[model samples]
Target: MGDFVKKLKTLKTEVEAEVPNHPSIEMGDVICEHFAISKPEEKTVNNPTRASNKENITEKERNKRRKSEKEKALGVKKKQKKPCGFCGEKTNLHTKTTCPKNPNARRMPKPKVS
Candidate 1:
C-alpha cells in the first residue's frame, strides 16, 4: 500500500508538470494572444520551380549567379560586362540626342562630295 501511494504521488506530479495551470486556455494560444499575433494561415501546395523562375530579378543578380556557376562547373568565368555595358551601352544615363557617337550618322555636308 505504501509503494502504491508513492507511485500515485509521482504520477500526479508528472501530470501537473505536463498540464497548464489554466483549464480553459492552452499554452500556445495564450502566447499568441499576448503577442497580438493571429494564428498562421494555412498554405496551399506549391510547384517547386515555378516560384524561383518567375521572380523579377535584375541583370546584375543574373550575371553574378551565372559567373559563380560557371567558375564552379567549368573553369574561370572568362568575360564579364561592366555596369550597363552588357549590350554595348557603356555610356548609360543619357538621352539619344546628346550621344557622343552615332554609328548611322551621315557626314555634315550631305552632297558636297558628289
Candidate 2:
C-alpha cells in the first residue's frame, strides 16, 4: 500500500509537470469567441447564397430548397437510419450489446469472471 501510494504521488507530480498551462485559455474569452460577441467581424459568411439570392429564386425552387435544407438539418435522410438488430425490427434506434431486448446481452461475462 505504501509503495502504491508513493508511485501514485510520483506519477501525479510527473503528470502535473508535463501538462503545465493546459488551462491557459480563459473560458470567458473562448465563450465570447464561440458565441460571436467579441469579434463580429470574424463571421466569414459575408454573402450567404440562400438569403442573398432568395429574390431571384422562383416559389417552387425556393420551396424545394427549403424542404431539402430542413431535411438535412433534422437528419431526416433515408440512409442514416437502419433496422434494429435486437428483435429484427424495422426501427431507427441504435443496436448494441447494451440493448435491453438483445439476446446477446446476457451472454457477455461480468467483470466478476476475471
Q: Where in model 1 is the C-alpha error above 4 Å?
A: 1-27, 40-65, 68-114
Candidate 1 lDDT by residue in tens digits, 3-105: 9999999999999999879768888889999998977678676668734444567767765543444354344223342333223454323223333354433
List, in order, the clash count of every candidate structure. Answer: 0, 0
Residue 102 lDDT, candidate 2, scale 0-100: 70
Query: How well is each residue in 32-77 modelled by candidate 2, as lDDT tens digits?
Result: 9798887555676667545543346676775565444556545643
The stretch of ten residues in a row with the least summed lDDT in candidate 2 is 105-114
- Candidate 2 lDDT score relative to the true structure: 0.60
Point out where model 2 deviates above 4 Å.
23-27, 39-114
RMSD (Å) per prediction = 13.3, 28.4
Give per-residue lDDT, candidate 1, residue 86: 24
| Model 1 RMSD in angstroms | 13.3
